[model samples]
Structures are given as structure tokens and as C-alpha cells.
Target: MYDTLKDTYQLFEEIGRGRFGTILRAFCPVSAESVAVKIIDKSLLTDETDRACLEKEPKIMTLLSPHPNILKIHNVFETEDSMAMVLELCEPETLYDKIAHRPLPEPEAAGLMKQLLGAIAHCHRMGVVHRDLKPENVLFDSRNNLKLADFGSAEWSGEGGSMEGVVGTPYYVAPEVLMGRLYNEKVDVWSAGVMLYIMLGGIPPFYGETATEIFEAVLRGNLRFPPKVFRGVSPAAKDLLRKMMCRDVSRRLSAEQALRHPWILSGGEANPMD
Candidate 1:
């Protein structure tokens, strides 16, 4: 653990600001490589629980680093005042940026979803639940490969078990979570489903001006693909989305199961619904 960031890496311009820290583009002389360093100020974490969660972020990334779709952490440094994580550098554009311009074509959306599901499956198999899954958490690398970033809300599920917590963003959170019920890794599938919807429709399935309204819309579980937005989407693609966003947790498809869906397996070549 270095006492400060400047002692080890050459920090550059701030590339991004996160919930508790700023991400800087950094260069490591020893490796002769560039990386993104997330530097968190310990003083900002006044709540003990928040600090504990922050401490776990890098550990979770380390535990799940083997998967190509997951962001890789190169090093972790900590001091009394700061926690810095050196991570694999990627393209600055996030999935959120891409979708904001317009919805992706079916083939492109399918390709991205496959990679996202693969990452989620790997996390689930490791007994880890990424409670927070959103477009902002998805990054693109230099080669345009999708990478799952940000594990601040992740939790270990204890050997294929379930966990209870009302954690997750309002737009993509599973209905079970809002109900304060014990939930499993399938919650990620729900969030991924929301991403899929946005990729194809350019808007989330649930809508509200406020968090409470969004939560209510989620609990209502009224899933529909507006013809104006979904006209060109394949039937198989819509089928997969329905299964993933299914309100009944028992019926929702797991990430592994979603990988096998016809739309994904066929790479979005499935016939579109007329």
C-alpha cells in the first residue's frame, strides 16, 4: 500500500468522476502501460458501512478478473486517506453514451447483450451478485469489447445462496428487491433486461420523473414493447427480453440461460416479428 498515488504512478487528466472518487488516466513506468486509477478519498466516506463497501470493490474485481468481459484490476494501493485501484484502461465511451445517441441495430444489440450476459454468468457462478447493473457500468475497450465495470454495489451470495437487500438503481432494480424479499443473482438478469430494452428501444421499460415513481412502475411490472420503437426487433429477441424481465422471479431467465436464447445464440438473426 503506497502512502500516496503520486509516489507510484504518473497521474494524468481526470477521465471520470464516480460516486466517491475521480478516475485518472495514469501511466506506469515499470510496466510501460497506461491504466485508469480510481482514487477515493477516505474522508468522504463518513459512514462506516459505505467505507466497508468501498473496501470490497477492488476485492470483488480481483475475484472476478479472469473473465474477459469484466474489467481487470492491475494493482490496489491504500493509505489512511486514500484507496487507489489501477485498472485496465478502456475507451472513454460507455454503453450509456452509445445508447443516448440512438437505439442500436438488432445485431449489434444482440452482440453486446451476449457479452454482458457472459460476464454476469461468470459472476453468478462465483457466488457474486452485481446488485448494480446499468449502461453506465458498462465500458468499451480499445478494441470495442464490452467490459463490466463498477462493483461498488456487488455482494457475495454465499455458495449459490440468496441475499436480501434493497440495493440497486431504481430503473433497473428487480421487483423482488423492491419488495424487500430475499433475491438471487437473477436480479442482474433483470437489470440486463432493462439494458437490452434501452439498446433496442432507446428508453427504459419503466419510466418515472422521480425515484419513487420509478419504483412504483417497477413493482407494477407492466412490460411492453411499443410498436413504434420495437417494430423491427425480432420475435426471438423480444421473447428473451420478456423472460429476463419477468416479474415472477421463479420464471425469470438466469444469465446463463439467457446466453442460450435463440436470438443471442443466432446472433440476432432470428426472424423479426411483423
Candidate 2:
């Protein structure tokens, strides 16, 4: 399958690889455009459910069209043996990779966070809940604008269908989600809070050697503020984090509320130097 289309797209080199597939930087000769093509192994489509989910992606991407902060899907096709998706190629790196290098300055963090929240707010308004909202899934365009990617875990909420599957990166999963309790858009807010924490402190509030330990830590709701590392984290920022990361999903801040938080909307911009 890939062998035939291989000639159509000039594959340069491997950009990323994951459990599902490999992404390559490629050029569409006919359109003279560059795109990141993700090639999924046919063998991975072992069951009917997997195939259904894989087929659903193109539909979901079509539904999310024209969003400024979301990666755009140009096309999807399948050969006799493989499936491929053409997507917008984002440059530089992911927010996760960036934070791993250094803590983002407060004003810069707030600006990026604002764009992320706006993107999620747009998703919620469209009745879509991006169940996975971790730093790794947030990509940065050339101008450093945030573009939410990897919608494999996203679920449409308007049709009255609710998500029951255990999804999302373990570090960012909300307590309610871990507890197996029914949840809503608030789950994304909790994940966003975790992202905010990483931006300020350059690490997650909870960490452990193993996945189980991390889950246990999250269940305990033990959030520590490393003031030494996050010297300039303001009171408003801390207050906002507390509200968004609340254990009880019912008390978690909504996207709109978080956007309007004093820290985000304050007359003065955040200053990391403070």
C-alpha cells in the first residue's frame, strides 16, 4: 500500500513514531505543499473496533475544520494494506518538549495558555471534549501559537454519547476519571491545570517511579508548590490552579471561568521576573 503512494509523496525523514504509527515529513508534489503523513500499520487494525475508530478520525477532523489552534487534516486515504492521514506540519516542538528544556516565562506562559484555553473553549462550544489535553498533544506553530493535536481520544458530546473508556495520559487524567466516575468537560479543565503547573514549575505536581504510584499520588490530591523553583508564581495564579485542579470535578473551574480568572484577565500581564 505505502509502496504505491510512496512515489506520490516525497518522504524526507521520520519525524515521530508512536504505538500506532510513524509520521514522516513529506511533500505533495501535485499541490506543491508539505504535510506530515502518518502511516498506520494494517496489522494494528486487528479488530472491528479499531477499524471503526481509525475510520472515525477523518470524520472528526472534518467536523473540526477551520479552528485556528487545531491541526488541520488535509486528506485521508487507505491502500489495500495501510491507512494514511495528511496533516498540517507544525514546526519546532511540542509544549512538553519545550518545558523539558526550561520553565516558560510567566507572560509567555500566560499568552500560550490563553491560546490553549481558547482552543479548548472552542472545542467545548462545538460539543467536542478533547479527552487528552496534555503538553505532548499541544504543538507549537512557527509563531509559537498553540495548536491542539492528536484527537484520537476526543469524543463528540452533543449526540448524547458519553465516554466511558479510560483514556488520557496518566499524569494529566482527572481524579474523577481515574475513579471511574462519569464526567464531562470539566475533565479537560483538570488536564489544562496540570499543563499550567508544568509551565510554571517545569514539572508536574505529581510524579512517581511507576504509573501506579503516580495514580496513587493523584488520588491523594497532594499538590505541592515548589516556591523556590516557581519563584514568581503569583497568588492569583496559585488560586486559579487550586480551583482548576480541585479533586471534586463539580468544583473544578469551567473553561470560561478559568479564562476569566484574575490571573489570566488581570490588568497587568504576568511577569516571570517578579
Clash count of each predicted structure: 0, 0
- What does the lDDT read for residue 140 in candidate 1? 89
- What do the candidate models score in CA lDDT, each in turn? 0.91, 0.81
Best by lDDT: 1
Candidate 1: lDDT of 234?
78
lDDT of 1 by residue, 1-274 (tens): 4545677789999999977889999998888999999989888998977887898889899999878999999988888888899999999899999999899998899999999999999999888899999999999899999999999889999754789879989899999999998889999999999999999999899999999999999999999999999998878888999999998888999999999988898888755442
Highest TM-score against the true fold, candidate: 1
Candidate 1, residue 53: how far the Cα is off, in Å:
0.9
| Residue 161 in model 1: lDDT | 77
TM-score of 2: 0.90
Per residue, candidate 2 scores C-alpha lDDT tens digits across 144-198 of 7789988777877755535566778878988777888667888898999999998
The CA lDDT at 147 in model 1 is 98
Give me the overall lDDT of model 2.
Answer: 0.81
